[model samples]
Target: MIFESSETSGFPVATPRAVPPSGRRPGWNKVPEVTVYFWTIKILCTTVGDTAADLLKEKAGLGLTGVSVLMSTVLAVVLAAQFRSTQYRAGVYWPTVALVSVVGTLAGDNLIDATGVTVETASSVFVIALAIVFVVWYRRERTLSIHSIDTTSRESFYWLAVLFAFALGTAAGDLVSQRLHLGYWLSAVLFGLAIAAVGLAHFQLDLDAVWSFWTVYILTRPLGASIGDYLSRPSGDGGLELGTVVTSALFLMVIVGLVVYLAATRVDVTDPEHTSRHVA
Candidate 1:
């Protein structure tokens, strides 16, 4: 199997990596290739995550704690299946992401709505937690590039960082929109602009790709959350009033359709033409 590592490639950095001479791993990278489709499906998953949390709480009467428990169980099962797979499988990977998005949303909610922690305080807490995860991950692995996720430990760190990103996004989104009254559409626009600036910096101003990727990843969560709220919330609340169920169903269907296409085409697989390139 091909082992994609950044020991001698991709955005330059000062840290050293431990790529083997062969650069081939006993197992392939368990994560999907980063592509436009990946980002599209990610935003859809986030939107569904935001709306589904509302549905589970209000429609299903699970409350914040109950939905948290239920989704956490589901996330655990899906993540176990993810860890068992040796290669990137859309069937397993995207489902785990979708479940993670939901659980992450609920986690942020429980901290604020249940524990009376202000969104600002909660957001700050998650920021510190995420920073600690990154420090620990990089200290151990000497690399934070997702392209290097060919080992179980690297994959574990990747998912942990992802969960923290989602939670942080939720708290920050609420703090700005719900607590500060920026409104959903405006919040989405602001985040969209921020991501665009990041892209510009990475491409034109010499920003680091690894940092750019992580920054954009975290920003996408709030963008998706804002979009979901704008579509599902009532007109009285300045939303389009589409309702949570409809919003969730629409995004979920789109995500499923895209995943099916991705699985069939394998278009997102990294370099099918040279899957055996040696790591330098």
Candidate 2:
């Protein structure tokens, strides 16, 4: 298993984080339904993204730029398929997410390692970029709900926001966990606590579901990255010394298993039509 904790890692919780959501969003599209299965696979994807990026860059002898270019190309091809599809297909959607996660990790990594950018600077830049994406998205679509991402423009915005969240999470996670010297396991715990607090606010305090969902989504990227490092880094580095290939393979296996199940069961597929609203 990935962890000894109550929850393994982070991702968007079941739809909206509300106790009893009155009006569900209408229609499904190119994404999985928000459910336990969805989060499980999503978390795995993040962890694998972290480890797989390492394997590609460090182990496979693909330099940072090489891995970035390679994965970006793959992500572009997959995204084209995803955008072309009118409906959600686990086969297409999850691979795109996995690729995006890897590429996102590389994006943040290149900023710090290739250039001389500080994690703090990269983190701040990503935050501003993400905010701009949201602003443009909300202005054009009038809603920020993932459930409403049926149209092409909205889907584009959704993917862009997702990419930024992963990139920002990568920078922020590295800053707190690595630059701050908290170490991997500690960083994982801290980020997990933050995510848990968000969960509490959403369920108990009536925090807006859409905001809470996105908050969790953005936060999980780092939490999973931390967990990945904790598992894969050398024991001399205060990690389990599992190795990048091992960690990546293990998490990838779990993700594939869960995705296959969800594909067959369709448990995470959303309704064709319901009523939901995001940031107003």
Candidate 1's error at 214, in angstroms?
0.4
Provide backbone clash counts, one per model: 0, 2
Backbone clashes counted, model 1: 0
**Number of the predicted model whose lDDT against the real structure is largest:** 1
Q: Best candidate, TM-score-wise?
A: 1
lDDT per residue for candidate 1 within 1-280, as digits (tens), equals 2223233332222222345423435337676677778789888988998999999999778778878999999999999999898778898999999999998899899989999999999999899999999999988877776655667787899999999999999998888786668888999999999989987887698677678778888899999999999999999998999999999999999999999999999776655323334233
Q: After best superposition, candidate 1 residue 195: deviation in angstroms? A: 0.4
lDDT of 2 by residue, 144-253 (tens): 76766667887899999999999998998988875678888888888889989988996688666667888888888999998898899999998999999999999998
Give the lDDT of residue 264 in candidate 1.
96
**Could you tell me which 10 consecutive residues in candidate 2 have the lowest summed lDDT?**
1-10
The TM-scores of all predictions, comma-separated, are 0.90, 0.88
